[model samples]
Target chain A: MSTGNWLDARAGGARLSRRGVLVGGGLLVGGGLLLAGCGGRERPSIESRDVGSDRDRNKRRLREILDRQTEAVKNKDEKAYLADLDSSNSDLVEHERMVFANLRQFEFAEFGYNTRRVAAHGDYTFGPVFRITQLTADESPVGAAPAETFRYRLAPKDGRLVIAEITPASPGDQKDALLSGPPADEAWNMTPLRVVQAADNVWLVGDDSVPDLEKFAAAAAAEAAIVRRLWEGRARFPGDVMYLTRDDDNYRRWFSLGKSSNFLPEISGFQTSRTGVRQNGQVYSDQRAGAAILINLKNIRDYYSGEDPRVTMHHELAHSVTAQLRATPSIISDLGSPTWAVEGFATWATGVRWPSEASRYRSQLRNGLGSFKGLPSSKDFYGAKRSLNYLLGWSVFAYIAQIKGREAAVEFYAQVIPLNDTLEPFVELPIFDGICERTLGTSAGAFLEGWQRFVRRGAGA
Target chain B: MLMVAAIVGLLGALVAGVGAYLPTNRYQATATTVPCRRVVCIPVLKASAVIDALKAKGHPCEQERDHHWKCELMVGTLTFETTIEEVEGLISDVSVLVVRPPDEEPTEAVMDYLLWLAALPYTADEALTEEINDWVVDRIEADEDAEAEIGGYNYYVVTSNPGSIRLRVIGALR
Candidate 1:
C-alpha cells in the first residue's frame, strides 16, 4: 500500500460534529461531577478555587475534577456521576451510562489511576489527564502492562466548575506529550462516542438515529451481557455504546468523529462501517473508548440461521478485551500472537464450533496448500487462503490454551508483542516446541507432528 | 454401292439393339428379382436396426414410433437397406448406409472412394453418410460378383443376368 492508501485505510475522516461535541462534553461533566464529591472536604475547596481568578487556582480546580472523576468511577455512583452532565445533551447522558457500564467490570483495587496536568487553554482547560496503568485481574493475562491517558476539559457550568469534555489519547499521543511535542494528528483523533445509561449497568449512545435508539439499546444490552459472560470475574475495559448506521458514508464518518475532542486515557471507542463482509460473521475496530464489533447485517441474516447476532458481537468484544489487556504501543504493533490464537480465543468465547466449519475449510486448504506455502503479502491477508492461517492458527492456539491453559497462552502473547519480530518463528516447529516445553511442559516437535496429524485427519474426514 | 452400305448399316444397328437387350456375361447367375413391396419394408426395418446399432455404440439417438419416424432416419442424403424373411435373420446381412454429401461437387468415382473410406473404424457424420452411398454401390457390385462367382448352382435357380439385371436390381433396390 502507498503512503496515501495507508493513510486512507486508517482515516475514516469523520469530524466530531456538534452532536459529538455535546455527547463527549456531557460525559466529562457527568463523570467529573461524580468524582467531584470523592474527597468530601476537597469538594468545597475545589468549588471555591473555581471562583478564584488565579490560573493556579483554576488549574487546581481542573485537577480536583480529575481526582473526583477517578474517585467517582471507583465508587460506581452512576446517579452522582450523571448528575453533573448537561441535561440538554441526551447523547452525553447516554455516553456516561456506557462509561459507567464498562467501569463496573473491575474492582476498585484493580484500578491504578493517576492524573498529570498537561496544558491549560483560557476557559476551556485540557488535562491533568488520568491514566489506568493496570487492571489487577484480567481474564487474559497480557504479558505487558498497558496504560491510557484521559484528557479532561473543565469549564464553569451553572456558576460552578465542571468537566466540559473527556477524550482518550492514544499511546503515540502520550509519547508526543512526554517529548513536549504536539501529538500526532492521527493520535489526537481518538475519541469515544459519549456514554449513556440504558438499563441497569447497560449504557446506550446515539450510535444510530433516534428512531433506532431502542434497537441500539437492546444491542448494547446484549453486548454487555456477552462481555459479562466472557470476562466474568476478570477486570476489563468498559463496554461501549453500539453505533449503527446503514449509510456507508455515515458509518465512516461516525468512526472518525472523535478527532476534535480531548483524549480519555482509559476509555476507548469502538467504530465500524456498515459496509464490508464480516469475516466469520464478525469484524472489529478498536479506538480509545472500546472496541466496536460490526456485524454485517446481511451476512447475519443470510448465514446465521439461529438469528443470534450476539455471537459475532462477543467475538469482536473478545478482540477488544484482548486489546485493552495488551494495549500495544503502536497502532500497528503486532500483539505477537498468531491470527489463529486471536481468532480462536474470540471464537471460543463466542461459542463458535470449529469442527463444523473445519471440514469445509480443510478441503479449501488441501486444494490450495501449494500456493499458500509462501508467506502472505499484506494483500493476501484478505484472500481465500487466509482462512487456512486463521483455522490452523486457531486450532494451534486453542490446543496451547487447552494444554498449557489460557493464562499461559495470553502471557505468551503479551511477551511476543514487545519483541517486534515476524510471526514465522512462532508458527514454526522448533520455536513452538520450545515455547510449549517451557510453557506447557510438552515437546514442541511432538506438538507440531500431532497438530499436523490432527489437521490431516481433519482434512481426510 | 449406296444401297449395299445402307443394308450393312441397318444390319449393324439390328445387332447392336439385340446385344443391348441380351443378358451380360458378368452377372448371369447371382442377380435375383425381389418384389418392390419387400424392398420398401426392408429399408424401414434396416433403418430402424441401424439406429439401434448406433445407439448401442453410445451415440445417443431419439427413437420415434410415429409415422414420421422413418423419414427422420434419412437425416443425410444417402440411405441403403437389406432384409431377411424372419426379421431376426435380418441382422446377418442387413445394413443401412447413411451418406453425408461432400462440401464441393463430388467426382464420378466418389462412390468407390467412399467404399474405401467406410472400411476405417471411426467415421464422422459427414464421412459416414458418404461412405453409406459408396457401400450401397459396392453391395450392388457384390451382387454382380456373386453371380459371376457362382456361374451355375445346381440346387438354386438364377432368374436374371448382368445387362438386364442391373436395371431390375436398381429399381427394386430403390
Candidate 2:
C-alpha cells in the first residue's frame, strides 16, 4: 500500500546509542578485543586454527565490524561508520553517508542491532561471503524497516570483513550477482543521468529524450510547496525527489514490495520507505533513509509519457512526510490505519482538492452512498477493486477537511489511527464506529451521513 | 516481394496451429467435483494437510474451539496468518486476508485445498466461480459435474471416488 524500496538505493544507517553501547556493545566489546588481538585481519587466525575455531573466529570478526558500525552510530562519527564499510565502494560510502545525515536530523536516543544470524557463503564472486540475518532498531519518531528478513553480505576486502551488499535481495540476486548482489551504485538505472537543477528545492536527474524528467521534478517541487503550504508551520518535510529511467526488471528488483505486481503502469512512481529521509531501528534500517523519488521510466516511455508524475510524486511524498507517524514508536498504528484514511488523506491533499475537476469519485460516491456503511476493512485495501477504496476514502477525508478543518483532520487522523491487534479477515464496522466517536465526536452513522451530504454537494457543484 | 510475403504467411500459420494445440495453461493442481444437492459439504485444510505444504512446513497451527484455525507462518520474515473458516462442522472457506507474503508462493496443494473448501455447495453461480479464479493463481473451472479438465484446481472436483459425492483435492502439477 505504501512505497516499497525494492533493491533500494537509499543510503541510511543505524547503531546503538551511547547507552546502547554499554548494553548491546558489552558482548561486542569482548569481540572487539578479539578483533584487536587479531589486528584487523581475520585470515591469520582462520589459517592458524582448526575449521570449527576458524568459523568461530570468522563470525567474531564479522561481529567486530557490526560493533564498529554500532559504535560509530552511537558516537555520531561519519568516519568511524565508513571505516566499517568497504571504502573501495565509494558509492556505498556516499549512500551510507547520506543515511548518517538523514538519521542525525532525528537525533535518535538509542540504537542497536537485534536478531542476528550469520551464514557463510564460503566463496563467492564478490569475495568470501558471510551473511547476517540482523535488523537495526532505534528509539525515535522516524523508524527502521524490519518488515522482511535481510542479510548483510560481508566479503573480504583488504583481508578484513567489509559490507559488500544488502538491498534488492531475492533468490535470483544471490545466483546472478553472487557476492555483490546488485551494485551498490546506480547499476539498476544503467543510464548515467546528468543531475540538473530545477527548483531551489529540487534536483532533476535525467538525460536527453527524457525532457519529462524535469517536468516531473517541477511537478514534484510544486506538490512539495503545496504540502508545505497546507502544513503551514507544522513539522518540516525535507527529503527531495530523484527520478531515473530503467527496464521493468529493475523496477521489480528495486521496489515491488510483494503486495503489488510490477510492470503495472498503475504505479507511476514510488517513494521508497515510509520515511525516505531517516534511518532508524536495527533491521533494514538503510532502506528507510535518503528517501529518493524513483520514477518507472519504462512505464512512462511505453505509455503515459511521464506527463504527470505529479499524481504519484504527491501521493508518495505524502507518505514520506507522514512516515514518522507510521512507525511503531509513533502513537498511530500505521499498519492498522484504515486504508481509506491512509490513502485518501494523500489523494485529497492533491487530486481531490479544490473544484474537483472531472471527479471519478463524484460518480463513485453517487453510487457508493447507496451502500455506504462503516470504515473499509483491511480486505478492502488489497481487494481487486482497491482503487475504489482510494476514491471513496478521498471523498471521505475531503469531506472531513472541509467540515472539521484540514489541520484538525490531519491531527485527528494521527489520533484515531491506533493499533488493532485483531488477526485477519477483518471487518472495520466496529472499529470505524469507535474511531469516529472518539475522534470526530460522533457515531459512524453520523460520520457517513455527513460525508454523503458533502458528496452530494460536490457532485452537484 | 510476393514470395517473401507468402513465406511469412506460411510461418505465421504454422506458429498459430502449434500454439492452438499446445496446452498453454499449466495447472499445478486440479480436481473434478459434483454439486451438493442437499446438505452442502465444506472442506477446510486438515491441520495435518497444512503442515504437508513444503514452504508451510513446520508452521505451528492452532484450531480454536469455535472451529477457526490460525497459523503464524513464515518464509524468511515475511510473516502472515492463514485463517480457515468453517460452516456447519465442515471447513467452508480458507482465506489469508491481509495478503500472502510474495516469496512464499503458496504451493498448488495449498491453493487447491483452499479452492476446494470455497467451492462447496456449488450453486452454479458466477460469483463463486470468480472467487475460485481470484485465489487459485488465475485458473477457473466453469463446468459442474464431469471430469472437465486436469487442472481444475481449487474446485469441489468430482473424482474417481463414487457417486455425486464431491471431494476436495489438489491435482498434480506437470
Candidate 3:
C-alpha cells in the first residue's frame, strides 16, 4: 500500500451526503446459530447436548455483559458499563466511552441489550443484532431515541466473552433468539460526553482547548444565523449543537465502517441525532429530529485550516439544522431531495469560497470530460466515482444561489425536499423545473444551462 | 572464420528474441495506490486522479462494495492489476500487482520486454495496449534492441511520462 501523507485521508475523512445504513447483530450463544465457511472442518457431528451446554454458557456470559451494563447505568458507573465491552479495538473503546456518557445523561429506569439470534462463524460468532434500550425517568415507557439495533459479535478475549464488533443492523438481518422488543424501538444510548459550551446553542465535546472549539461554535453560529435568517418559519428544531471531536477515541465508535480507504476512511464528520423516527428500520428521520455533529479536527484543519472546526461543522451542521425539515411520511418530504440539493445547500451554506473542492472538481472534470450526464445520484455521493458528484452538486446549488438569491434557494430547498427522486417515472428536469417554477418562480431550463456553463468555466467541464 | 562469426551473430540475435518472447507467455502485475491516511485530503485526491487516469485509460474498474476499487488490464502475457482505495468521498492510495503463471527468474530478454510493459504509463497512448497483446511477435520481428552498458552489464530503461504522472521503469537481464 502506498503510504500517503496524513492529509490524504483527513480531507476525505467523513461521510458525505448519504443514506444511513446501520450494521449490527444479535447476541451469540456459545453454540452455533448458523455454521458457515468451515471448509470441511465444521462438522455437525457434535451431539446436541454438548452444543446446548456451550450455548448455555455463552448465553450466561452475554447476560452478564448486558446485566453489568444495566447495573452500571443504574449506579451511574460509566467505567463499569464500558468494562463490559471488548476493548480490543481502541477506537471502539473510546467510542463506547462517548456513547456511555451520552446515555448517562438520560434517566434510565431500565437499560439493557436484548439479543435475538447469534451465528457462529469459525473463530467468531455474530448474527442479527441485540438492541440497547432505556426507560424514561420514572420508568413510564420507552418513547423515542431507542438505541439503533446494534449487533454484537463475540469472541473469548482475556478469559471473558467480549463484543468484537457492534454494527448497525441492515435488512434481512432480523433473527429470532433473545428478542425483547420491537426492532424499531427508539432509545439512543450515549456514552460519556465531554461537554463544553461553545455557544448558547452549541456544545463542544471531549476537548479542553476552547479557542478552536469556540471558533467552530462561532462558525456554526454563523451558519445557523443564515439558516434562521433564510427560513426561520420552516426551519425548526434548533439548539444544543453537540460538536464531537473527530479523533476522540469515544466519539469514533459512533460509526462502523469497512475498509480504511474505499469507505471507512472517508469519515470527516457526520450529524447524528437523538431525534428522528425509527421508521422502516431507519435510525434517523427528518421529522422532529434533533442532532449531534461529529467533527473531524484533522478534516477541519486540512480543509478549513486548524483555526476552526466549523469549516466542516458549517457543512455538517447545515444538515443538522434542517435535518428533520423533511421528516418521512410527508407527501412532499417522503423521498427527500436529490444529493445535489441536499449536499449543495450545505456546501452553499459554508459560503462556497473554498477553492479546494472546486479545484479538485476541475481536475476531475478534465479526467472525465463527459462524465456529468445529469444531476448526481446518492450513489455518486459516496463511491469511486469520487467527489465529482459533490462538486457538481455544490455547483448546482451555487448556481441556484447565484440565479435565485441564497434566501430564495433556501426557501426552494425547504419546499422541494419532500419530492422523491427515487420513485418510478423519475425525471430530474421536469420535476426540478416544476418545483423551480412553483417555489422559486424561475425556469429550470435556463437555470440548468447556467449551471452547466458555471461547471464548464469553473470546473473546466 | 568469417562464416562462423556471421552465424554466431545471427544465433545470438535469435536467442535474445526468443528470450524476450518466453516470459511474456504468462507474466502479470497489479498496482494499487492509497489516497488517504485519515480523510480525503488534496494529496489523497490527487493520487485518486492518478487512479482516475488509469481508469480513463480504459482498464476495467470494480469498486468492492464500499472498499477499494480493483481494476484489471491484460496486455499479452503481462497482466497488471491495480487497486485503489476510496472512502466516502475520499481516495486513499494505489497498489499494483504484476503476475505470471509458474515462471523461473526473469532473463535479460524477458526483463527487456517487461520494460515496455512498465513504460505503458509513460507512453500516454493506447498503442502500448495493442503492443502488449503481441509483445513476443513484435520482439521477434523487432530490429532495435537495448544497447546501453554500464559496469559491463547491459540495461534497458524507459523514461515514462504517463499523462504528467512521472514514474521510472528500469530493467536488466542476468
Task: Please give, for every candidate in the order listed, the TM-score of chain B alone compared with the true chain B.
Answer: 0.23, 0.32, 0.35
Q: Name the runs in model 1 displaced over 4 angstroms.
A: A1-53, A65-114, A117-124, A131-299, A305-307, A317-335, A344-355, A367-370, A374-385, A395-424, A428-431, A438-442, A449-460, B1-174
Name the lDDT of candidate 3: 0.45
Models sorted by TM-score, best on top: 2, 3, 1
lDDT of 3 by residue, A1-461 (tens): 11121112211221111121011011111112232232322222211112223444554466567678878877879889788677768877877776677666554434554332233344344433344443231111112334445555677888878876666553234453322122322213333344545555555554432334444556666665655555566655545355555454434454332211233333577665443222111233334334556666655555555436545666776776776554343444344456566776776666554556555555665566464666666534567654666666666666666666666777777766656556432335477678778766767776667768777766432
Report lDDT (Cα) of residue A406, candidate 3: 66
Stretches of candidate 3 above 4 Å error? A1-102, A105-146, A150-193, A207-226, A240-243, A246-252, A257-267, A273-290, A326-336, A352-372, A423-430, A457-461, B1-174
Kindly report the TM-score of the first chain in candidate 3.
Answer: 0.56
Deviation from native of the Cα of residue A70 in model 2, angstroms: 13
**Residue A164 displacement in candidate 1 (angstroms):** 6.9
- Report how far off residue A332 is in candidate 2 (Å): 14
> Model 3 clash tally?
89
Measured against the native two-chain assembly using Cα atoms, what DockQ does each of the candidate structures obtain, in the order listed? Answer: 0.00, 0.01, 0.01
Error of 2 at A226 (Å): 1.4
Q: Residues A1-461, candidate 1: write the lDDT tens digits.
A: 12232122112211223343344334434543454444332221111112233444555565555456566777887776566665556776777676665565443323433332244556465543434423332212222222344565655678876656666554246353422212212111222333345554444433333334455466557666755564555545544434433333333344343442321212122332111111111111222223334333334444557444554555566666555543322345443334455555555454333355545555665665553332232223435555566555545545555556656655554433223224344445355456667766667667666656655544344
* Worst-scoring 10-residue span by lDDT in model 2 chain A: A5-14
